[model samples]
Target: MFLAVGLGNPGTRFERTRHNAGFRVVDILAERLGVPWKSEDRFSWARGVVGDKTLYLLKPLTFMNLSGEGLLAFFAHHGCAFEELIVIHDELDFPPGVVRIKIGGGVAGHRGLQSIVEALGREDFVRVRVGIGKPERRELVVDHVLGVPEKEESIILEAAEKRAAEAVLCIVEWGVQRAMNVFNAREENGQKEAC
Candidate 1:
């Protein structure tokens, strides 16, 4: 079994914010798979299959800071290993709409990532990063992430969310190495890389 976790704050207030990029990606995946989410005490989940593999899509309701709590509960019940876990979240380093795949790394101060690392006691899980770009002033970081993007940026981000969902599917179908090759290379070439 493979588990994919999308990090974001729950509720309509945060629905379109840049910080909710992960949730957007997972939402797309769920729609594509025609799976309906079932809400748990701490999170919501949808189950589907891809090429004979069962994949669980999770969205924590504990919000961004306490995301790990919901994840820990999921682990306790469903029992998944660190290696089989994939986390999707926003990235401030890359330009808006850029998507990247990574295997284990620091949280880069992302509260959601930090929470997961703390709960899991490891940082080696797979990550699908959806870039939201950074704020001009360091002090504006919070406002930037939690704020909704401009019309043009929203269009870009919407596309990125779809691509991030595709990247997750690719990783499940062909493994992380192949997914990284396809996605990361695409990033460099400024063109879609065939999987």
Candidate 2:
């Protein structure tokens, strides 16, 4: 069994925000798999099969900062290990429209990731990172992530979200190394090159 967790604040207010990139990717995956989400107390989830693996998609309703709560509950219920986990989230370091795969890394001060690490007592799970870039000023970081993107950036991010969803499928169908080799490539001038 594999659990793919998407971190975000729940509600219409955050639906189109940069911080909800993870949610967007998971939604895309759910649609492609033709699975319907069933709401629980701590989170919403859908189940489907990819290859021979049982895939579970989860979106924490505990919001971004407390995302771990929902994940912990799911883990306890499913008795899943950290190795069977994949987290899809927005990346402030990379440019918009970029999607990358990472394994066992620091949280980079992302509250949602930090919460997961705290709950799980590990940081070795796979991650599908959707780039959202960052604000010019450090002080505006919160507002920037919580706010909706501009028209052009929104289009780019939508593409990135779709790519992130593909990355998740690749990881499940193949392996982390293979998915990284494919999705981690950088795009330059409309062409893709190794990163």
Candidate 3:
């Protein structure tokens, strides 16, 4: 079994926030797979088959900063390997419509990823990062991420969420290297292709 964990804060207050992009993508995946989420031990998850692989979609309920604690518990319960895990989260570095896949990298100051690295004791797991561009001013960083997206940005992000779901399937069907090659490639104009 492979684990696909989507990071986000719990509660309706954060439902539509830019920082919850990972949750949104997981929702899209659940929809596509015709599975319903079930709450279980500090997280909610759904199981489905993707190209002969059993995929477990996880959403940590301990909020963003404590996401790793929940994920680690799930991993221990399921006896899953670190390499069989894929983490999906919002990225502040790229534009709002971008999605990228990579394996093992610095967390770029993301507290949720930091906690995951701390708990996992390694950084070699796969990552599927959806972009939610940074604020112009440093002081507005928190507000920018927690705030709801503008109408146009929301539309873009929603579409990106669908793409992110596709990327997850690509990883399951084709492996991370091919998923990265397909999902991380840029167009001629330097825009990322939505794989």
Candidate 4:
């Protein structure tokens, strides 16, 4: 069994914010798989199959800072190891519309990831980072992440979410290595020549 976690704060108020990119990607994946979400243990989740592997899509309701609590509960209940988890979250380093998959790294100031690392006491889980870009001014970082994007920016983020969802499916259907090869090297032009 594989656990795919999308990190974001709960509540309708944060629905379309840049920080909720992970939530959007998981929603897309659930829609594509025709799975319905159910509330359980402080999180919303849907279960489905990709190829022959069982997939669990999770969205923690503990907000960004306490995300690890929800993840820990799910892991304990499902007996899932850190290696069997794939966490999706927004990234400020890459430009908007850029998506990358990696395994085991520092949180880079993402509270959601930091919480997860704290809860799990490990950094071996896979990460599917959906870039939302950084703010122009350092002081605007908080507002930028929590702010809704403009129409054009929204389009870019939407595309990134879709691609990120695909990358998650690829991980389950193929494997992490192949998914990284196909997705991490992708360019804005949709070219996969090289990174």
Question: For this target, which candidate reaches the highest lDDT against the unseen true structure?
Answer: 1
The estimated TM-scores of all candidates read 0.97, 0.94, 0.93, 0.94
> What lDDT tens digits, residue by residue, belong to model 3 across residues 113-190?
998999989999899999999999999999998999989999999988888889999898779888888777751146
Q: Candidate 4's error at 74, in angstroms?
A: 1.6
Q: Model 4 — which ten-residue stretch has the worst lDDT?
A: 186-195
Model 4, span 1-195: residue lDDT tens:
888999998999999999999999999999999999998767888999888888999999989999999987776676665337899999999999999999998999999999999998999999999999998898999999999999999999999898899999988888899888888767545765421
Against the reference, the lDDT scores of all candidates come to 0.93, 0.88, 0.87, 0.90
Q: Rank candidates, lDDT, best first.
A: 1, 4, 2, 3
Distance (Å) between predicted and true CA of 135, model 1?
A: 0.7
- In model 4, the Cα lDDT at residue 94 comes to 92
Candidate 1 residue 138 C-alpha distance from true site, Å: 0.7
| Model 3 residue 142 CA deviation in Å | 0.5
**Across residues 7-56, which tens digit of lDDT does each residue of candidate 1 receive?**
99999999999999999898999999999999989999999988888889
* Residue clash pairs of candidate 3: none
**Candidate no. 3 TM-score:** 0.93
Q: List the residue pairs that clash in candidate 4.
A: none
Model 4 stretches astray by more than 4 angstroms: 81-83, 192-195
State model 2's lDDT: 0.88
